[model samples]
Target: MEPIDDLVGRLGRWSAGRGPLFLLLATRLRQLIDDGVLPPGALLPPDRRLAGALAVGRTTVVAAYDTLRQEGRVVRRQGSGTRVAPAVPTPGPRVAETSNPLFLHLLDAPDDVILLSCAAPLGPPPELTRAYATMTLPADDLGYHPAGLGALRTAIAGRYRSQGVATVPEQILVTTGAQQALSLLTRLLVAPGDGVLLEAPTYPGALDLFREASAGLLPVAVGPDGLDVDAALRLMERHRPVLAYVVSCYQNPTGAVLPPLKGRRLVERAAALGVPLVDDEVLADLTLPGGDGPAPSPLAAYEGGSGEGGVIGVGSLSKVVWGGLRVGWIRGPQPLIARLARLKAVHDLGSDVPAQLAAVRLLAGFAPVQAARTRALRTGHDHLRAELGRLLPSWTCPPAAGGQTLWVRLPYGDGVSFAQVALRHGVAVLPGRTMDALGGSGPYLRLHFLLGPEALTEAVRRLARAWEEYEPQPAAPHAVAPGAVPAIVV
Candidate 1:
């Protein structure tokens, strides 16, 4: 988008509420061109001239034009102004292999589109952003740092301490992202064919990683109460998996929090069986409440100094500040962290020094990022829960005490197909199978309320529309209307 004179004035005159003017122009204009308002071979106004007409930044005009060209909404010949395209190619899912397009597709979607796909914080707090921008020098300000700085290690450990888990900085190895941390741990701890116990609807990509390691994946049941503790224990004892990865707080698919009681029980049981607990507290910012009551600290806390080992807690700043800020770390026994650090060096030398600096700034400036996350996600969450309760009474959402999304079990629908339908309806939804280690969601969908009215509601409504289409029976006769019960065929 280029600078244009009176850009603000034009937008004020023509634009409506809460949308990027440039984006709106691009969208509406593309629709116009498609409808033949601007016939093929018709010239578009020059960027600067158009900016004057719309009273928007010339950059906005340039962007609108660029998008038009990119999407084949228009064509430009050398020495000629842009011309309407004969046809426009509708945008479709871009499945990129080299880089994860799942993340990128998110960026491409409309800002108002609900983002249930990624477990991301709604947005960083102002204090956090300020702190990140004001990070100090000398710790290699612009240098590359693979292992997070000693300061961050101390701060992260301090964070866990308040939650009653005392850990040493040396016991924490910071990586680029929590996903990266998990990847490194898998490489270091899991050997091909090693048994790995995971929650059935566990983190989806993790299954892929464990598979790549050739680990024999085992699924343990997790119900509305969270992880089926006894079931998990049995699986752990039976398989003696090389890694027993579980999300302790605000679990991904279920938004299940492992309360303190269950956390202790799980740790003790795992220790008794000699199974490592790779606890991912990635979304454990105490940001969302759980249906089962208060959230628990890391399961590793239950380990204490029992010297049993095998309890490692993984987390990162991506959820708190920005996903672009690729800084994740693991806290466990010092020896294990050191080993993980060694493992981290293999893929990439280190995290960006600037990012580490920003993280440090974030930690110091804000009392705790968790505090800010809680405040930010609350309103959106309440609205989402309320709307769902009213519109989809059959859907089960077990009141997440804290997390970014609600794990919803559709009473009579398959999550996978619903998600596919959501895409066609212009909403983004992640089904249970994709998130599960086992390929079944049992009619579940993860609804992210963090995006708020900006996107969440529309997406949910779109999902509701999809649901409406899925109902098998047509409208019943007057006897079967709202107040009356129909005859039961069975």
Candidate 2:
């Protein structure tokens, strides 16, 4: 049973300027019932006790109870003071089934809608814009470079080298974006019905690509401590998957980083099991402003010592630079790079050369650009946390170490229903079910924190409104909710 005083305290902004305080209290109680905060069969305090707790007249409590009884929302027994009404059928469109999982759908959303679905950073680094402006394409006409431009490839490779990994341009393959690279690799590595191991709640786009390929999936749990190495090792041994994908740094949605020990163990185990590992470092550079020490090394760094030649590192400037740039590359053994490049050529001829030039310039100023992004993202994340705490205190959202989104668990309803409600309130959020490969993630929502503090504050306010509109009616607790490319440049 909820304490009367606590309920009274929660009446923020709901009781102001109300002519009938008893009616206002009744409305609040109804909402509480709807929100499942007060479950059915929950006994309410005695009218006199409640009045004393709320510092209101006993007549007000009696009036509120009488109103609830008249509406059949509550029943009063001789001994039992009051009990919530039984489940009632609610009529509405099924939001979960109709909700669009496609990220592109938000592109057409009205300007006023706050899109929390896609985690794309607000804007590109200013340096990237400047770079693109000053960049000059080669004099050669009708540039068709099947392999990426030589300059950008070398720059990407050089960064890998700086990380103590010996990489040459030949061992790199660039594509329109990381997604294309993923598709090409999936095509090359996974045949129809082949097993692929992935973290349970990983990138939705990756899951889409794998499903399109008709690959059998094996999911391992990724918790706050990161991926379970023992479970991963066991899965690899049993499934012997053709490819294993992981987000080792600043993982998507959850923002859980794989600790160094777990990372090393995973690489070693994968090598032992002969299962190739695809390490996604797309958001690797977006570490928070301060850290205990340097970020963990790429899982691919262990590939040299593993001697199995399985780790393929996929990096993108999308998070650190800009998503529209669509500049991403795969780093792996030269032989694998050559094969992927051949497949890539058959797909899109090559990535845009101008973007490649711009990426080269952006990398040249990587430090400053990344520092600025880190600062902005840190502020955005903190603001999001503060707003959630102040507005929707019941929702649980842990701070993300890094990454664009916060994976949140709702206090009462499931993510799909809440998302539908959120959309009607002009905020678009990605339901957690879309990210899970095995259909296990429900009751969760992935919220992006890339907006400015002001925007995030307003967005949370909208979310709170939606939360209020969400009738917690316990209707059967309607369960809520890479490759080395050796090819010449054109």
Best by lDDT: 2
- Tens-digit lDDT string for candidate 2 (71-148): 888999897678887655456621223224334454355777897777788777779878977878788656776668
Question: What are the models' TM-scores?
Answer: 0.71, 0.75
Off by over 4 Å in 1: 1-104, 107-113, 139-144, 287-294, 306-308, 473-490
What 10-residue stretch in candidate 2 is worst by lDDT? 481-490
Residues 241-316, model 1: lDDT tens digits: 7778888777766876666788889888887888878898877765553444456667877777632367888888
Q: How many backbone clashes does candidate 2 have?
A: 11
Give the TM-score (vs. native) of candidate 1.
0.71
Model 2 residue 135 lDDT score: 75
lDDT of 2 at 103: 47
